[model samples]
Target chain A: MNAATTTRRESIGQSPRALPNTSSVPPRSLPNDEQRLLARLRQSDEQAFDELVTKHHGALIRMAMGHVGDREVAEEVVQDTWMAVIESLDRFEGRSSLRTWIFGIMIHKAKDRGVREKRHTTFSDFETFDEEQEDAVDPSRFHRSGEWAGHWAFPPQPWDDQTPERLLASQQAVQAMNRAIEALPVTLKDVLILRDVEGVEAKQVCDILQITETNLYVRLHRARERVRRAVETYLEGCQRAV
Target chain B: MAHDASQSVHEEITCREVVEWTSAYLDAHVGEDRKQQIALHLAACAGCGAYVGQIASVRDLVRLLPQTVDSPSESEQVRQAVAAKLRRQ
Candidate 1:
């Protein structure tokens, strides 16, 4: 790993306050293409702004949906996020990737809108959800007593034929995974969407969510486990039907 | 079983601990000591291997799944709105 990644990994157990101020520290220097894009955005190039919105709007809407009541409200939140992005375009230093900055803004607005609407539980309430107290895997899956007590009682069956392409090819599997992701509590959902679905790096994800690496992995593992369970269930049903 | 001997020899971490560490292990985020333990356990334990494989699949599949993009008109509308806001500023 590079020096930056090494530093991020070493910061794992440090308190958030003990970590360096990420806002003051740009995660990395912006890539040349991103720098060019930012310059065009600042120049009031409508096409450039359009490109930015089109690129991120879908992701923003999907992520916002995780926070709020419905698609309409999610759209509103994203629209507001775009306006905020436009307003702040000039002020955006290359501290974070534009994608990271845009996501950070949308998450802030989405949480605010989610609170105002009261349609969903807020992040503060989720803070009490207690990552430490929950087991990502079902405890029943393990034995209760004996030498192998903590070992798998019913280990996951191998998906010999399953691949990413094949899994997505199955409509039932796709639906199952989407439902599993949609059903996640906002805390788990946020990390999963950003880290797994959006393909953000772990460090950038931590930066976007203002979470520690420890919390990010905890939440991300839970999220992935939930989806894995969903796919497992779907596969089991398919087996039974055969 | 073929794994029983190695399982007993490398009993420092259980399948339970392996399950918890799967994501970090897959991401290479765990410490070298813990990483070695988990790697040895995974080598001996078929259950943990399958579980880790499934989680890894889930991680890759999530990004590969089709994203829901906005309709063209909706995209046009957002573009216009953003353009208008940029002009107003």
Candidate 2:
């Protein structure tokens, strides 16, 4: 599904709520690529920092945007992430890629933001919804017609030869999927986000998360299942309506 | 044959085994025997396989979401904000 429909912007021209899509951009890996850039950045090279920011700004924004769901808030988070990165460069031990380091800081910032947001207002409890059996209502009870499954065959994938109209519809589904992903438990959310969205390798996720490979996999596996169910349930609802 | 859902611990995957397999599986480092075991379990166990598939979809969905690019000027706002902080440090 196109990601735009599920992600509504506060304004017509404003950026939509960001989904954590990092794999397409490879900055999360390549420790050496980062090292070279950091070397220049450390020398007080304003241009170097500018280059780094320009290259990474969108991904970072998207990253923060996923956590906060607001463009202005996400923008601030990215700025804070860069500031934190600059301040901590000297302490960076080349243990992980610069991207990971920056992201770690961003996650912390995002979590902090989440805590504040939680205290200010209550968010809807999606758990009750999750608990409801997806097919429990027995789609047949309502329609009395042929099953909806025949009309639907796994919505065309995002990269498929989708029409502009179809793509737009798909984007909405993706946006809803993003919300479900965000609602996942932190442990599962982090593992899935890092492994799937960011496209970090299993080894990198383990290193960055400081968890054993075994633990990471279990979390990843379980997390993936949750997100998939969430996405499937969402699409199923849309299909039934059609 | 499907293992009895009400079977004892001995009849089901132990917590330790699940942990061990999960670790190896994450690293893509599981051996053939354990791999087969996991695959068999996953294939027969809709719940477990659904778990694996969800993560896969999440990963794929995240990868496929189109990036929301902003103007260069928006980035400059970040640069300017950080530059002041950088000067102090």
Candidate 3:
């Protein structure tokens, strides 16, 4: 093989996909295209900035929506995030990517908005988080007539078919999730949303939240567990109907 | 009341350990040791197991929900508004 071909093959083998997955890779940096665009953006290239905004605005909007749950509020949050990105351009140290930088801004803006609205649903009641209550599941409530041991032994059934009804059921489940998330303490909710829902890495969550890795994991663990408990109880009711 | 609070606190396991092991148990993250630890703990501790099961259920439920995020209609509106505002600057 030619030297160029051999070199290309070696490079591909050394890429990120070849590496073992670990939390070492920090989140936020410029993708090649984004880096190029940022250079142009620094020059005040309007088209480049426009393209960047178009590509990312939708995602930012949805992220805002998740935090606040109101369309208008979400739109405003994204708007403010963009404004912050523009205003802070001079200070952009390129420590994280422009996207991460913008998201950091958006998260703060959305959370601040959430606090300001102070309008929350009844879902935040502390009584609902009582993990002890889950143990009260009545054996009689389940159709345990069959071998209880065998029942426990069997794997959980795969989800049923995709249908409109299934879709609605799932939406209800997500609503339950959102409510559960909304009920979490602000710090926990931020970690859970950024790490779990947004699929950001652990390192990124820690960076965005300005928390140590240990503290980040602690908050994430508690937040995730709380959301799990709430969603489980919600689904348990749905299971009864099936 | 004192007894109940103490028992509940005593019952609490390391949230970090559980969270660390859960991804492995769920097969999203891999490591036999973690899965084993989580499985063994779950077997011994029903409450933590229930909590684990709840997380798995929530992920499954998200699959059933509608794709509501970043709907094209709303997205375009926001895009135009932001673009206009950016242009003004």
DockQ-based CAPRI category assigned to the predicted complex of candidate 2: incorrect
Question: For model 1, what is the error of residue B56's alpha carbon versus the real structure, in angstroms, after optimal superposition?
Answer: 0.7
Identify the runs in model 2 with alpha carbons over 4 angstroms from their true place. A1-31, A54-77, A109-118, A121-169, A238-242, B1-31, B40-57, B67-74, B83-89
> Would you give me the overall lDDT of model 3?
0.54
Query: What shift in Å separates residue A50 of candidate 1 from its native position after superposition?
Result: 2.3
Tens digits of per-residue lDDT for model 1 on B1-89? 11222334334898998898788889888776677788888888999999999999999898877665457777777888888887887
* TM-scores vs. true structure, each candidate: 0.84, 0.58, 0.56
Task: For candidate 3, write residues A23-135 as lDDT tens digits.
Answer: 22322365776566666665556576667677667556656665676778888787777666654454454556565566777776776786665466233421233332232
lDDT top scorer:
1
Off by over 4 Å in 3: A1-29, A40-74, A110-169, B1-74
Question: What is the C-alpha lDDT profile of model 2 across A1-242, one tens digit per residue?
Answer: 12132122212233455434332233433466675676666665777787778767876665555456567887877787777667655545454666566666666676567555554433542122222233312233232335432221222223223422342358666666666666665666667667776677777676555677656756665555555555667656766999
Best by TM-score: 1
Backbone clash pairs for candidate 3 read A29-A97
Tens digit of lDDT per residue, candidate 1, span A1-242? Answer: 22222223222333322244333333347898887887787777889988888777777887888777577888888888777766666556566788887888788778778877774545543333578889989899999899988999999988775466677998888988988877788888889988887788898899888888888888899999999999999988988999
